[model samples]
Target: MTESATDTTPADQLGSGPGRVLVWFYGVFTVAAASRSIVQMIMDFGKAPLAYVLSAIAACVYGFITYSLVRGGEKARRAALVCCAAELLFVLVVGTWTLADASAFPDATVWSDYGMGYLFIPVVLPVLGMLWLRRAKR
Candidate 1:
């Protein structure tokens, strides 16, 4: 039996496979969260300034983390780990608070209600990102 270049698996699979998936997911969230934050900030910052700012921060984190993962280097991988930690904290705290006091939001943020509006990608993405970074351990 023989395998072609397309045969990606346990061997000859090339660089960080899981990292690829994480990067893709993070890239999507980067666009989604950044767009949402920008619109919210421009539309009515006075309505939910804090939430919007957090959204932007989250967006930036997602973008940087994605970049770090794709970078495939020691420093970049470590950077991704740090970003993943921050994301996990943000999701947990914001998710809990939003579920507890939706009124405090005044408007939806990416982490609100455990990212229900974003289909919980915020919750799941960090875990995958962390796992991928760990695997990439340069």
Candidate 2:
């Protein structure tokens, strides 16, 4: 048996590089997402179903991202990309709308304040994670 020319032998070096950054971001996101959802769900599940559901979704995505990083491969890479992209979209839309109309968001989601609660790291990390995956795929 032999390897394909398309094999990313060199790229995997990043498994220990700033890809560690991807790992860190995923870790942070996982904790943040989980905590936020847990808090909201416990405090007042009936407050906003849409927002709470989205929060739960975000937590699941974060967990997926974390798992993908720990188990890197083509499939994990794709999963991580999809998760991060969703996070980016979530943050952008939630951030803009929440700021524009404060009345609508009775409480901030994990993506609120442009992820200011997390120093906007949540907003930026996903974009970075996707870039890292693209580079690793190269």
Candidate 3:
């Protein structure tokens, strides 16, 4: 009745436990940011090209992190960790820049104002992601 360690699969290892929530959040952000950026770009790229581009970049980062979390391996874990750090940095820099020079960004990006528009999920998610990733590593 005992199961062998070899019987465990990657799927069982990833997108399970606490990682399940992380994956879900990342997936949601990916879709939200991507769709928002696409719509903004189509409707009025001239209004806030920088913000829209940043939104697209954030979407890409979120998508990558979501995929890595789902993949569930050492490689994917490392990639997710790195991306989480980068995401945090982007949020901080963009947030500060937006605050200091509001005119620079006619519109807001996912990271602008530390994700105030998104209820600060974009600001907080990466910190939680990095912490979760570190815990998952062990």
| Best-fitting candidate, scored by TM-score | 3
Candidate 3: pairs in clash: none
Each model's backbone clash number: 0, 0, 0
| Model 1 spans with C-alpha error above 4 angstroms | 1-15
Model 2 lDDT at residue 95:
88
Please say which candidate is ahead in TM-score: 1 or 3.
3
Q: How does each model score on TM-score? A: 0.85, 0.83, 0.91
CA shift at 67, candidate 1, in angstroms? 1.2
Arrange candidates by lDDT, highest first: which order? Answer: 3, 1, 2
Task: Give candidate 3's error at residue 88 in angstroms.
Answer: 0.2
The models' CA-based lDDT, in order, is 0.81, 0.79, 0.91
After superposing candidate 3 on the true structure, give the runs of residues whose Cα lies further than 4 Å from its correct spot.
1-12
lDDT of 3: 0.91
Error of 2 at 30 (Å): 0.7
Angstrom error at residue 39, model 3: 0.3
In candidate 2, which residue pairs clash?
none
| Cα lDDT, model 2, residue 59 | 83
